[model samples]
Target: MQYSQKVLDHFMHPHNVGKLENPDAEATEGSPACGDQVSIFMKVDENTHKIQDVKFLSYGCASNIATASIITDMAKGKTIEEAKKITWKEAAEELDGLPPVKMHCSVLAVDTLRKAIKDYEIKHGLAEEDKFSTDKIIEELKKVIYPNVGEDIVSLKMVKYVGFKDGTAIVDVEIPKFDKYRDNVAEEIREHLEKFKEIKDIKITM
Candidate 1:
């Protein structure tokens, strides 16, 4: 697939590529099975709720790196509310345009940023601890529609296990690495689970 020059530029020299030391808030969002994952760290002003600094670590293709690079630049200096409004479509437009198949890269980037903000909200006592239990998460998974089959994974018995530890959620699926739908399933799971603020990260095992 051909990528825009803007995409190439950011990927080659991805901005804000590192970890923040004892960051005020941090988040990770992605599916390793899909081959793209991004982690975002932010230093937010508690009084004003503005982002003082932002950084990221990306593990994916050029689109993934570029999306992460641009989104960090957009988030810095913005109020937490302003940062929350940043969308995947806006990130893609900032990079000119991404191929339809690669649009999910921006989704991964945006989701990570939003999750980081949620972490800030939780720490500041603006939000409640996630009330959704492990059983609730599994029930939510049953609602996700697989793109091709028009069926939920639960009905197909694709989901094998669901576990939690230290706020991170682990979902095990029985899908071959070479299957085209493998990453799609993982990404769908991530999207479905994003509303759970207590989930620090998602691990999709194939």
Candidate 2:
């Protein structure tokens, strides 16, 4: 896969790549088992609500490191509200574009940053924790990209159904039997939904 020069530069020498000793907010996302994970730390100015400093630690491929590096750069000096507006597509565009298969790295990076900002908001009583519902599950599904096209499965109309009850969540996705990303989509669904404490078991059908 061909990577843009910017991606290569950030991958080779990532900026703000470290932990903050006394971070006001922090968050970790992704799973090592899936081969990608990121942790974001932030020092915020209470009065200004600005991100005084931001840093990240990434474990994955070049795209992962590059996305994390650029994301922290985008977040630093921005207010928590401004940083919350950062989107994965913008992050990818900032890196001059990432391959379809590697686009999820940008999504993961943005998700971690948003989580960190949420942590700060909750800590400072700026926001309240959201209640978990099937809608939340659907929202998470929107984050699972269809690698073949670099679009979310939800928007692709690949998700046929979603239901949650008791401690189990059931998802029915529409992926061809011969599709190479079938298993990947299922795994992505599991990974995203498993984070909810309300969900004890996941059932995915394709």
- Each candidate structure's TM-score, on Cα atoms with residue i matched to residue i, is 0.68, 0.98
Lowest lDDT sum, 10 consecutive residues, model 1, at: 143-152
lDDT by residue (tens digit), candidate 1, 1-206 = 67899999999998899999999999997667557789999999889999999999998999999999999999999999999999777998999888766776787798789889989999998886556789868976774545445456777788899998898899998877787877777878887787678888998888
Superposed on all Cα atoms, the candidates' RMSDs to the truth, in angstroms, are 6.9, 0.7
Regions of candidate 2 where Cα sits further than 4 Å from its true position: none
Top of the candidates by TM-score = 2
Candidate 2: tens digits of C-alpha lDDT, residues 1-206: 89999999999999999999989999999988988999999999999999999999999999999999999999999999999999999999999999999989999999999999999999999999989999999999999999999989999999999999888999999999999999998999999998999999999999
At residue 24, candidate 1 shows an lDDT of 95
Please report the TM-score between candidate 1 and the true structure: 0.68
